[model samples]
Target: MNKLLAGKRLLITGAARGLGLDFAQAACAAGAQVVMADILDELVEQEAGALVEQGFDAVAVRLDLADPESIKAVAAFSAARFGEVDGLVNCGAIATGIGGPDMCELEIDTWDRVMTVNVRGTWLMSRAMVPHLAASTAGKIVNIASDTALWGAPRLMAYVASKGAVISMSRSMARELGAQNICVNTVCPGLTLVEATAYVPRERHEHYINGRAIQREQMPEDVTGSVLYLLSDLASFVTGQTLAVNGGFVCN
Candidate 1:
């Protein structure tokens, strides 16, 4: 209600579309300056331009999460352009479809690729930006996780493993960065209808709907509010916690 992100300079990776884009829009609407980075260079630029035209503080930059040098360059760029980063949403990830081999057929290379983007990417991005974030009064890192880690979903072994690592890394980050006043948290998304989930079998989607207590599919927008909360002063005392955003897919 107080435009919780006002005056906050934030960066959201994998923000060309889907949840990342949704979160960026929400953050911008709340009066924060947003930098949307993604691997899809053209889409990111287009989306960023559109947001800019709409009077939002947004910019799209090319970022290959798997490349460490690329990660550092963008961090430097953001710091130079924004002066400081108040928050970060580590939303960049490689869904299993990209190179995911099935559980039994999954290759070691596939595992490395998934881990490279999902786990290593989050860590590298946070490490690169933490210094700039430390300069802010409400420095925060919100890592996007998955319900697979919570429920141990089958056939997605690599993805589940990577997300599990993200959860563990988030906890360690919380312990280490708390002294710097940076709150690190993980948001585990359920079977949300994002483009990345398009490859999922219909049966799997229905399985979620049938099993969920809410009995409804989650939209990308459904997760944005919680993400905003994590980035705001309201969550100042909350850290090292994994908040599930699924529709009762794996409720505690």
Candidate 2:
């Protein structure tokens, strides 16, 4: 059977581990040349090398979402390696845990950091990649969001706010880039049990599981299918949309 992303080059940010790593692997399995980028340079390199050993066309690049220069550098690196970037998965984000305070107790610095990486960073990365994506016959962009944004989860004001911004920005980007034949969309996954979410309280995890229609733990793989569809020709006309991959947690 022919692969869905044959001959395509895709870049996935925050790909050192967890959901980002899963995205890279899925994209590779679907026949796209994957560039796994993350701030964790060592880990990203190792992950990419492992995929290469597995006979997949994959590479790694260091990316600091908070820094525009780093974003630009990674974009250039990816293009040099693959000639053009056909798709982008913006999976890099800063979440609550380090300092996720309630709205009344939220720190300004925490909010700034979350916004810088989650919102501004996604925009900057897309900005740098738009030209390359425009060059592709099937250009696509998928921004990873959280279901918390849809449900308005409490206490994680910064994270929720940043993700909300991402959802809104995706719509505008889709409209703007539609003229270039580039499809842009957001995928909002429920509370997934990825390494980055290990700090979540057990009760909170149970809450999400119980609330979900599937009544099971949501994993990184559960979200990959939606992303894969979005990046494929199957979704060429499915732009400016937000698909919730949370097992019916947020039906829209």
Q: Relative to the true structure, how large is the alpha-carbon lDDT of every model?
A: 0.91, 0.92
What TM value does model 1 have? 0.96
Candidate 1 lDDT, 1-252, residue by residue in tens: 358899889999999988998899889999899989999999999999999999988998999999999999889988987998999999999867622466889888888999999999999999999899998867999999998899988878899999999999999999999999999999999988988888888888888899888898889877999999999989999999999988898984
Worst 10 residues of 1 by lDDT: 95-104
Model 2 Cα lDDT, one tens digit per residue, 1-252: 248887879999999999999999988999989999999999999999999999999999999999999999999998888787889999999897733578999889988999999999999999999989998867999999999999999899999999999999999999999999999999999988889988988888888888888999998889988999999989999999999999987897
* TM per prediction: 0.96, 0.97
Model 2, position 2, has a per-residue lDDT of: 47
